[model samples]
Target: MNDVTTDHADPRTVRLLVALYPARYRAAHGEDICATFAEATAGRPRSAVLRECRDLATHALRLRLRIGPTDPAGRVLAGAAPVALALAAGCAGYFLLPQLRELVHRIRYPYPGLGLGHAVLDATLQTAYTVPWLLALGIAALGRWRSARIAGGAAALLSVGVLALTGLYPYTAGQMATMALVGALVLLAPAGLVDVTRRGRWEMVGLALAVALPMIAVDRYGAQHLLLPVLALLPIWLSAVAAPALLGRLSGGRPDRLRAAGVGLGALPWLMPLAAVAAFDRPARLHTLLQYAGACVAPLGAAVAVAGAVHLARRVRTTDPADPA
Candidate 1:
């Protein structure tokens, strides 16, 4: 006996349920899903309608990760980001090796090598800004070691410390704020840090606070000349850290080199605006920063990405495996 009465139903409740799905997915099945919800809740109270809305959101997430049909394009894009990042890091390491080696040689000599000391310091600065080693470390901690939760929690604290020390910059973008939230969420998941739950959402909230508090405090107090440009940075750094899995998701089923290029090119739009800002505002300084940051961050992203790709690939190939990668 199915009893759904029209008298207790409200149409507005069904409309909100459609917002959960990714835009492409939503466009296809949203109508059917909402229609079913409407039919089932025809005479439900306002509170019941709200409950349905909550249920729809949860269902959409479940479908995205576990049940829904896989999107190959999404996977290919996801895979390519790490590959590109890895390649870039390799090139940087090739160039930086000589300087690092010379620095080590000079450090051993009886005389103090001021030039070599400067070179080492310069190399450190270069590596830190461009390479994103810390970002990769976080990814590896999450994906491979089964210590993502612990790693993420520790990183969260360190990130706060970094943000606090660099109080000279403004945290302007909503996207940056969102990325921090995502990072926090990633940190708060079980020691594995894979599942998305209410606790996960709270983790995101905590991360947002972690990032936001420092930015607010710094901007309110005083300004300092930090070597790394803060405003131009937080967005990319946060995005890279928060959405590390995006590249893997986009790489699709057995994505090849051309597909990888396509994915990298696709990411250019979001990148172009930042590049433009860096170019116009501090062209020479930006170039120097990019060089240094690239050297450091690229290798980190590569190591983690290759590890993840190998792990995921192996999982896809076998039911039971001796090693993950």
Candidate 2:
């Protein structure tokens, strides 16, 4: 077997890979790990060398987290605020732009048959659609946690009132339950802006309801068309729920708990439509099945990606600073 010495190994490549670790970590153990790699990969195939590099990278991350300055909870908290803000921005854009366009249309093309009061009511509803997200985005961006909390709370109450009046007034058991869950999620989300606690997690049961009760209500009502409004507002509902959980997780809450929240919340927007369809009790078409299947799967995929990103962020933030690069 050829004994490849440190000089014989590719220093540049090894250094490049080592750079993936935290600067302080690399400063402390980079040369030693590289030497170990050179010795281990002597007379090995290219696949073996690649495998060793992967292992090294994994070890580096483990060490970085283990020896880093911030604790797990602290790292999570710090990262969560930004995540919340981003989610708020995305939701605002998704739900707001369409309303803005409609508002413009209303201005340009007034309805001839509509009464003045009705027209004013229509305009008020349109404004309601856009205002909560705008408030959330602004307050969250400004780091005004208290104001954001108030905005979220107000939005939740307003959403319930609107839904009850227009969508499900004289509410059935299922609708009542669904709205309760939405309210809980909205109320608890602000907690994520600072930190997540055991109590906050208990409150997140709303997430489960957010996913399940909508379908149950649709089935009970035998109204397939009801799925449209539910699905349309789902992104906003999810953003409201997820922003806080992400904030809590990034701030220092348990990742497992946060990941579970993410999975449940993420699954709802896409899966609710399918669940509504299933409630229809009709024959399933192949194309429809495929479409719903994709919808159901997309959120799960996104949940996994989000979980991985959170983990990576945790590791990156926890690096030791004493060691020089």
Candidate 2 pairs with clashing backbones: 73-252, 76-250, 76-251, 77-250, 77-251, 77-252
lDDT (Cα, 0-100) at 221 in candidate 1: 51
Q: Which stretches of candidate 1 lie over 4 Å from their true place?
A: 1-7, 12-35, 54-69, 72-280, 304-325
TM-score of 1: 0.33
Worst 10 residues of 1 by lDDT: 187-196
Clash count for candidate 1 is 34
* Candidate 2 Cα RMSD after full superposition onto the native fold (Å): 23.0
lDDT (CA) for every model shown? Answer: 0.44, 0.51
What would the TM-scores of all predictions be?
0.33, 0.42
Error of 2 at 168 (Å): 4.0
Error of 2 at 131 (Å): 1.1
Clashes of each: 34, 6
